[model samples]
Each structure stands twice: as C-alpha cells, then as structure tokens.
Target: MAVEKFETSLKKLEEVVKKLEGGELSLEDSLKAFEEGVRQAAFCNKKLNEAEQRVEMLLKQKDGSFGKVPFRLDDE
Candidate 1:
C-alpha cells in the first residue's frame, strides 16, 4: 500500500492506539503496530512543527513587511 498522507498518518496513528488499547490485536502485532504508529506520529509532529514555523515566518509587522516571528510550540 502507498504511504499515507500526513493527516491520514496522524488519524491512523490514533486509530492504531485505540485498537491496541481495546485488546483487538495480538501481543506481537500490537507491539509492531504501536512502533509503526509512533514513527508516523513523529513524522506528523515534525510536519506540524515545520508548518508552524512557516506561519511564524510569514507574520507581517505594522510596517507591512514579513519577517521571522517568535512562536512557541509549547503553551507552557
């Protein structure tokens, strides 16, 4: 099968954990799936971080020019 898109990968990761937590997959398969899901989730998170950085880079000041802006990935 083709590699899933970022959004699809994220959704699949969620589903994977939900299924594993529900006791639907065997021990071995659950471990394997959890590993794969973790990898996908990391990819999704990286993409999200990159996108957020891009948005911050596009922020314009009152002078009507774009420049790098400070953006916090963590709310805390």
Candidate 2:
C-alpha cells in the first residue's frame, strides 16, 4: 500500500465523508469514495499508532538527559 501523510490522508477522508453524507453521488461514486476513505483512515491510524509508540519509548533521565525505555500501558 502506498504511504500517505497522516494530515493529508485525514483531510481527504473528511472530504470523502462529507461527499458521501451529502448524498450527491451515484452509488458507484459513493462506493469509490468509501473505499478511499477507508484507506485514508487506516493510514491515519497507523501513523497515530507509530507516534504513540515513539512517545512511549521516550524517557527522561534524572540529570535532564533523554533515554529510551520500553512502553508499558499498565505502568501509567
């Protein structure tokens, strides 16, 4: 799958949803929009997950140094 920037994908997905909800397109067009919207949503979700993982890996050292630490949801 081609990678799309999260912001761009999200904006496109929003436009697709607006078009779909407007009920102005033929069934075929609506289907196409829905498919593209799905793909965009998936891309946005993937990017968010990756960012969350990166944030979780970050650690602040006692001397104000930065380090890497495994992320743990339960520890929070």
Candidate 3:
C-alpha cells in the first residue's frame, strides 16, 4: 500500500476491517483482506517497539529534562 509508516498502515487496516465487517465483500476478497491485515499487524508491532525505544530515550527525569532510560518491553 506504500504507507509512509506503520501507523498509516495500521489505520488503513482498521478501515479495511470496518469494511469487511459490513458483510459486503465476497469470501475470497475477505480472505485476501485478512492476509493483508496480518501483515499490517506485524508492521504495527515492529513500529511499536521502535516507538517504545524512542520514548525511553526521551524520558524526562525529576529535573524536568530528558534522560536516557532503559528500554524495558514492559514499560509500554
């Protein structure tokens, strides 16, 4: 779909899901839609990881300034 980023892809996927949920598409089309959704899900997961790392790097300390912090997976 040539999305600029994972968030864009995820939004597109959400739209697709809404359309499919409307019960208007054929079975084959729905299957293809689901496959694309899986790919988008994976991309979103990767983007989430990268975003978490960036957030950790920019975390503010008690001094009201940014400081480096460990990127813990559970932080999200």
Candidate 4:
C-alpha cells in the first residue's frame, strides 16, 4: 500500500501476520507479505515515537502544568 495512515498501516500489518501464520502462501508470496509487514511496522513505530516525543514535551513545560503544546518533529 502507498503511504497509509497509522491506523491503516497497523491494520494491514495485522492482516499480514495472519496470512503468514496461516501458512498457505508460497515462499515468494510469504516473503512479499513479510516485507510489507516490516514496512508497516516501521511506519507505526515512527508514528508512536513522534507521539511519545510530543507527550514528553507537554509534560516538561516550564510551568509544571500539563497542557497542550505545539510540537514539530526534527525532520518535519
């Protein structure tokens, strides 16, 4: 799939895992599915990491109060 949203990528990753566990695909097909799954997993991990950074920033505000804070990922 092309650049999917985080939820969509996670759902596709789950589907990929199910297909691999079912053991019905040929070796080549299984490898392809595994590669897709890896991509999705990496996307999800990056998203989660960005979110964690945002939360940490919010918690570290100088006023010692938890509140919404604007965030920008370094690479963005």
Q: Rank the candidates by lDDT, best first.
A: 4, 2, 1, 3
Each candidate's lDDT (Cα)?
Answer: 0.78, 0.84, 0.77, 0.84
- Give the distance in Å from residue 7's predicted Cα in candidate 2 to where it truly belongs: 0.7
Q: Candidate 2's residue-wise lDDT over 1-76, tens digit each?
A: 3345667888999999999999999999999999999998998888877743254487789999999876767877
How does residue 45 of candidate 2 score in lDDT? 84
- Give the poorly placed runs of model 4, Cα more than 4 Å off: 1-4, 52-76
Each model's backbone clash number: 0, 0, 0, 0
Q: Relative to the unseen true structure, what is the Cα RMSD of model 4? A: 9.5
* Residue-level lDDT for 70 in candidate 4: 76
Would you give me the overall lDDT of model 3?
A: 0.77
| Local accuracy of candidate 3 as per-residue lDDT tens digits, 7-73 | 6988978987887888888999998888888888888877766633244457778989887776657
For TM-score, candidate 1 versus 2, the one ahead is 2
Kindly provide the TM-score of model 4 when superposed on the true structure, using C-alpha atoms.
0.63
TM per candidate:
0.57, 0.63, 0.58, 0.63
